[model samples]
Target: MTASPAFERLAIVGIGLIGSSLARAVRAEGLARTIVCADANADHAARAKAIGIVDEATTDPAEAAAGADLVMLCVPIGAYADVARTIGPALKPGAIVTDVGSVKQAVIDAVAPHLPEGVHLVPGHPVAGTEKSGPDAGFAALFPGRWCILTPVPGADEGATRKVADLWRACGMTVERMDPGHHDRVLAITSHLPHLIAYTIVGTATDLEEHLRQEVIKYSASGFRDFTRIAGSDPTMWRDVFLNNREAVLDCLQRFTEDLTALQRSIRRGEGDALFDLFTRTREIRKGVLDARQA
Candidate 1:
């Protein structure tokens, strides 16, 4: 006998890279009996349908969410509150609401109150993405071997949480539960800060003399080219990410600034030993990440 689908109906509220990738993944895995998506961009909604991954597509989040067993807000963090409010009324009893945003604490703050009673919010971050956007950028292979973190609020329904976790597992993700605040703090350092630095470095290059800028691009090394790719991510989404997670990001930025100042002092004072020790420690951290990926 065929096993039951994880969800009777799954509604995704944004059809960009992550949303469309999820639709493809769910369909490929038979995780949902029906899949629907909404995008503020009408063309994106139409593209999602034309691609044949979703059963329905609409510009109205509420209409797509109506009767859905699982509603995933795949929009930027800045739009979370409005989308939650729009879909809250249409959510059926016991529906599970989740998200793929990077920031967790603010997502909970924005989405929790708007959900109807009996609806559970299990905020999640898929910790995987590319510097691409729009429906055409989606692929089913994005989730495999990636970490998906869930941050269920206090007193959240265990069943709903498990259902969502199972769906991610079926997509080939490793699941871990975390406190929302801690999730934000950790991401601020590992993800947010790196993106910020990339943007800054690329932006600085852009501000250089026209000749120097041309040379930089012409002779770009792998390091600078990688920074450009990170900096090329959707500007609207990154703006919202930095705004919505300002407190945590700012805290991390402050610590980073202090460390940077110390490094500058070490260089200015000709303290080669200090620089060597710092480089050695950071090299170990990079090795750890590589080892984990290999394992």
Candidate 2:
């Protein structure tokens, strides 16, 4: 006999890129008996259903969440509490509520208290995405070969955590468990800081004189082009990310500023050796990334 699907009903809130992508992935993997989505944007909710990635779609979080065995919150970090509150009453006992936000500790802070007893919260980060948004931008292949981190609070139900991990595995991600604080610190450097830098650089370019700005775009090198792509990500999402994880991001930013000041001093003093040493070390990190097949 064919095995049963992992979840009887899967509900996804925020049918934007990640949310729609997850719905597609779940359908592709046959991991849920039914998939439904709710988006604050009515157009997005309708588009998700029109595209047939979900069995049903609504503008109401509670409506979508009712009777769902799994509820995935794909909204921005700032909206977590409100969404949780709206869906808490609708969530049945024993339901698993998880998220794809980059910040973990804040998610738990916002979502945990609102969840009814017996409803498990398994905070997660898929560690994948592009500078894209909206329901049309998602695809089932986005999770393949990427990492998905789960940050279950102490005393969380082990079975719920395993089921969420299994869902990501079925969607083709390699899963790892992490402490929420550690996950925030790690992502602060690898993802958060980089995006911050990109936004700063791109914002600087936009502030240039009109003629210079046009010229910058006309003759843009690969580096500036790459920064533009990163900066092109949804503003609401990144704003929530930076705000929610301010402490870690600010810590990383301070260290980066200090390092940058040192580099400036080296250049001003004509210290080629110091520059070379720094470049050599950073190059090894790049090589390591490539070696790990993550580049």
Residue 32: error of model 1 in Å?
0.7
Supply the global lDDT for candidate 2: 0.96
The 0-to-1 C-alpha lDDT of every candidate, in the order given, reads 0.94, 0.96
Count clashing pairs, candidate 2: 0
Tens-digit lDDT track of model 2 for 1-295: 1689999999999988899899999998889999999999999999999989999999999999999999999999999999999999999999999999999999999999999999999999999999999999999999999999999999999999999999999999999999999999999999999999999999999999999999989877856999999999999999999999999999999999999999999999999999999999999999999999998
Question: Mind giving the per-residue lDDT tens digits that candidate 1 earns over 1-295?
Answer: 1888878999999999999999999998899999999999999999899989899999999999999999999999999999999999999999999999999999999999899899999999998999999999999899999999999999999999999999899888999999999999999998899999999999999999999999999888856999999999988889989998899999999999999999999999999999999999998888998989933
Superposed on all Cα atoms, the candidates' RMSDs to the truth, in angstroms, are 1.4, 0.9
Predicted model with the maximum lDDT: 2
Angstrom error at residue 49, model 2: 0.5
